[model samples]
Target: MAGLSAMEKKLAEYKCNTNEAIQLKLVRFPEDLEDDSTTFNPEYSHQVFGDDEVAFGFKGLKILLYYNAGNLSTLFRIEYTSKVNENFDCVEADDVESKIRKIIPPGFCTSTDDFVSLLEKEVNFKPFGTLLHTYSVHNEEAGEDITYQIYQADMTCPGFRDYHERLQTFLMWFIETASFIDVDDERWNYFLVFEKYNKDGATLFATVGYMTVYNYYVYPDKTRPRVSQMLILPPFQGEGHGAQLFETVHRYYMSSPTVLDITAEDPSDNYVKLRDFVLVKLCQDLHCFLPEKLMQGFSQEMLTEAQQKLKINKQHTRRVYEILRLRATDMGDPEQSKGYRLDVKKRLIGPYKKKQRELAKMRRCLRPEELTNQLNQIDLNMQHEQLEESFQQLVSDYRRVLERLAQA
Candidate 1:
């Protein structure tokens, strides 16, 4: 046991945290190559590294992947103080390079000088597809208004497929459970955001973030556009880029006569919040969602108007109504607060009601002995507790939406 403890202590020194060891940078100029401010780390490495996200057999590890800001031409390098080799015969070092090579495309520059040379060509790289919208955001830190543009792009666009290959590599880092989509499918639509800046008296563009939507055919003639993936790089996050990207995409589909509604595939909490904010903002302006109408409770007219005006589906329209209703409610008034809580709790009880109906059917169909087992599975008091918990959690989420709406 003493000898085993000594060997274990020695081995621990070789393990490196993959998330910390990896360094990512988006280089805009030659000077940015050495600027520490340009660097950011990946939020996830488990897809490349294992569940623990550790790289073994390196004492001081630095896995550098730098990309040109405009075209995303990459530079890959690995540095370390010491590495485990044949001398540590009992344990094998993690093959970090091979795993990364599979994800990062071929033809990446291996030297800093080569990467700098690629930056010069960035001036010629222009955003692909038809430019749809342009907006400027005030960067408090830079003390200047920065301009951004959103473009509707597709795989058919010139040079976009190759650019997308490099761009989609970011999904692996930023989005959990992200996988490469079939760009070959004509149904996939791409929306991209880029920062338009003037360098050397000429306009140059840098990639900020992008989103992908896949259109599924609805019955008869309409189509349903489902947002599949969205990502805002670390440097550009917290500046309303995500909201802009999402809203732009939503509006783009709104103008189409054949679009049924917009939805998302396995949306994260952040995405859901963004969606709620956008939907409420859009619905709040409509005549059907006036304060008096919201106070009256959700109506078919509200649902019809939301679907017709914004292409919002029934489920989302109901949610938007709840949020708008919460905004109109006066929590200070006991009567109004009670009405609002009951209204929301009614919706929250839907799943439990569904289960109860199923349980009733089982009771009629199953034998007494089988019914006993089923009855034992559910506790009525616990069900009430869960319903109250869900209702509270929902109100908390709605309040957050209202706060952001106020700020907006």
Candidate 2:
């Protein structure tokens, strides 16, 4: 720990102890197929676990899979534990049959001969995509029209459950701590975005991205919708698809009287940026956040308007004020820049200033030498340095947002 910084020293104490990886094998109808003839390499494989490297919440951890062709009958799954892997647990198809019995959907057979016969009658049927909302945009460079549609669905929808299960495979590739959810619960709602296009003279819909939100009851007729997972696949990123998806979800809830507000669970930095941009855009159109009011500084008027109109919490509302104020500010002018810095630092220094007042009271009960020791713990110089560092970082982040706003 010699020469290590305070933060680094703290991190050095933590450790990750990992053993060998678990290999789960499932051979469907092993009896019917010839020995070693039913071999397959998963077309897609995804692991679902928590941050502490444990299954933590569920009965056990799981690996969702899809075979060569993307369809319901081709899907397979497994759930086991670290003990199973560490103990070198050898499981046969018959051993795991009961665990997977309830998981298999109706009409799907575990019997190899029957399952193979069912695939022969299977048609590559595309499930009907329910249209929740739609908007049109033009390909500015190509001078053509592009129609984007957003669909909302529940777990009870037939064929949709299979579609969603397959879609979550993308999360393992994109999100760091992403885990699959229990789709059997009706509280979960899905929002899907797709591009409606014409290929080979037939209208086709290609997926762009999706978001999953859980509705939590807020007592006495109110419901708070918390966004659990959101992803705009790599191919469609940087095209403002994220913003569109967010605002569309926001608008959906805003229209409902029973909904209190929307929140995100342990949001990542990129998701925070998307939320800020979407909120700012929505708030700017309201009369309370116009240039004159924003320059006057954040007020009760601003807080009330944001909460009533958009359901944005007070903490987020304050941050939005700073962002919009920065957009309206003339940073090149020394006076304007200094004023902005002072406003932010005032909020930042509040806790430090309160600590100073508390220390004065402690002086009454302690000796002069003891009082000095306690006072020394509250370093004014360090507080000032931290305040400046925080303010500068905020300004840098605000500038980037402003640049994006200009482009938008």
Candidate 3:
């Protein structure tokens, strides 16, 4: 809610100014990254350099930025663009360092060579705790059983808090805000996913992905565990690991007495899909959301059951209700299909109705011609078509989730 800090403001400025003519300021010192300690992502460089910016071989340069423990580390890697360098107005290392210090606070190494050497050092990343949950899924295509393990660790865990710093750097590459949270605050909880396989008569583990949850206090003693950043590394995506991680976190909170309903912070489209699937799966087991009850239409029973049994809030519970109801309705029956469409349409029309009310209130303030012009822009005909199209697409999406739910 607060305004951006000086470093964030400058970074934003840098992002806006990036072009072929603008030379990179961080290229002089790799350790001069914007150190927010709150977020980082290598892909974010694209925000400044333009999407998929290519460096034609050592004639060009690439700049990377990351933050750890309140220290910024900038990386300047060169490619084959030597001829390209002669045309740009490059700043000397001293000026570049002075420019960086204006934004990021003081801390950490300022040497590019030392930073490169540190990256060259080998580091081991593995499961941070004993197994919390394990399940085997049959990969029909491969004709093999794949095993996944979910592990839990807190900020208080020995060596885990520090190890998480190294592990979470992966977030910078995938998540836009890849910086580490303050683990010393002791309010963050971590969940990790790993795949177990055997090699040379020994067991091996590969890091699949992870999620971070922050506990926010409600009135009195209750706590809300809001999911922060969740990443299923590219190699582990497209499988059901996301659902596995989400459901595991949901179940963990469901078992705790002091925790309230779970929530997520600015979830992406993929996460929303995975969450809907998992919530539907979990809700199906409750009596209130059974096929018979879902067909009876939504009621307080469904909301109360979902909140008490699964820690799902009322808004999400309503969404789950629509999805389940769609699954229950048979499109072959024209009457049942019409009822579902009407239900979804009513929700879709809410924004349009609100706009109409706003326009009516504005009638007295505008000239007759201006009012006519504004009303013409409403285009109710197009709105109706859009509403129907949206409802149809929604039903199609719901069907896909239902099919997956049935398989699961």
TM-score of each: 0.96, 0.67, 0.72
Per-prediction RMSD in angstroms? 1.5, 10.0, 9.6
TM-score, predicted candidate 1 vs. hidden true structure: 0.96
**Which candidate's lDDT is highest?**
1
Candidate 2 per-residue lDDT, tens place, 1-408, comes to: 564586444333222211112222222233423433333222212332223332222223343332212233533444444333242233212223333333333444434455455443333333334676778777776599788888787776677887676566556646777778998778898998877655345554556789999999998999999999998765457778888899999988888888888899999998988888888888877788898888888899888888788888787888889999898888899998888889989988998889988998897788999988988889889889989999999888877877887788
Summarize candidate 3's per-residue lDDT along 1-408 as a digit string, tens digits.
Answer: 245485344333232222332222211122433333322223343322335433221223333333221111333332222432243344211122333233333443445566645432312334676567898777777799989899998866676765565456556446764455777777888998877765345555656778999999999999999999998765567788888889998999999988879999988777777888999989987889888888777799998889888999887898798999998889889999888888878887899999899898879899999999999988889889889898888888788888999888
Candidate 3 wrong stretches, greater than 4 Å: 1-44, 47-126, 138-143, 176-180
Deviation in angstroms for 78 in model 2? Answer: 16
**CA lDDT of 342 in candidate 2?**
93
- Which stretches of candidate 2 lie above 4 Å from their native place? 1-130, 136-145, 351-378
Clashes of 1: 0
* Descending-TM-score candidate ranking: 1, 3, 2
Writing each residue's lDDT as its tens digit, candidate 1 over 1-408 gives 999999989889999998889899988888987888888998889999988989999899999999898889999999999888745876888888999998988989999999998899999999999898899999888899999999999988888998898898898888879899988899999999999888899899999999999999999999999999999988999999998998899999999999989999999999999999999988899999999999999899998999988999999999999999988999899999999989988888888898899999998899999998988877789989998888888889999999988998
The candidate that wins on TM-score is 1
In order, the Cα lDDT scores of the candidates are 0.91, 0.67, 0.66
State in Å the error of residue 80, model 2.
24
Of the two candidates 1 and 2, the one with more favorable TM-score, higher being better, is: 1
Supply the global lDDT for candidate 2.
0.67
lDDT of 1 at 266: 96
* Clashes per model (N, Cα, C within 3 A): 0, 0, 17
